[model samples]
Target: MPQETTDEPGVTRPRITPLDIVRTLVLVVALATLGLWGFGSWTMPWNIVIGIGAPVVVLLVWALFLSPRPVLHVHPFLRALVELLIYVGVTLAWWSMGSAWAGIAFAVVAVTSGLLAGRRALT
Candidate 1:
């Protein structure tokens, strides 16, 4: 499918990049995790250290050297998997969480987002 993008009429639109999807996923994961954790519903000892910490570190280091474009050498699924794992880890951390519904919801959303992004990146 041809990827439609926002344009400035006369000016070409800045094409969306794989990194943009990654960044979008980053925001989604960060917000979702925080919302879950903040609600006092999800608490995993190492989840924060891994999920939150690692992404920040990776993004910071990556930004120091990388420039973004519509074309990305990295695969979208890999990026999504990393994010999904982080959130999954966080969800798993809360062993005491009685309800299983929330985790399922998060998983569904993550996977759906990942697939959409992967397809977009490919095109």
Candidate 2:
């Protein structure tokens, strides 16, 4: 694995790869889709509020704290935490809508992707 070495001899950063880029794009698209699906599935006033508000709120949050150029300038672990929270929340939202199969599939993908990212960070 390629390591991102620093000026100091032993310190290094996780080397970002093409696969990482692809994974990031996948997550971004998934999050956007989840936001749309979640809000669109709501009832009545919630539908009115969430249908319009959820996408805006989620995208704002993503741009602020989760994106590569986060406005908040958070730590990588913090970024990862936020990502996991959103992913799991979306999974639960699907499950709540009685889409058990979709929920399970999404959960599996999200978890597997997260683990892969974590492993790369550790390496």
Best prediction by TM-score: 2
Backbone clash count, each prediction separately? 0, 0
lDDT at 83, model 1: 52
- Compute the lDDT of residue 61 as modeled in candidate 1: 36
TM-scores for every predicted model: 0.47, 0.65
Q: Output the lDDT of residue 20, model 2.
A: 75
Alpha-carbon shift of residue 58 in model 1 (angstroms): 8.7
Model 2 accuracy (lDDT, Cα)? 0.72
lDDT of 2 at 69: 62
RMSD of each: 8.4, 7.5
TM-score of candidate 2 on Cα atoms, chains taken together = 0.65
Per-residue lDDT of model 1, residues 10-49, tens digit only: 8765777775776566555645555444445425766555
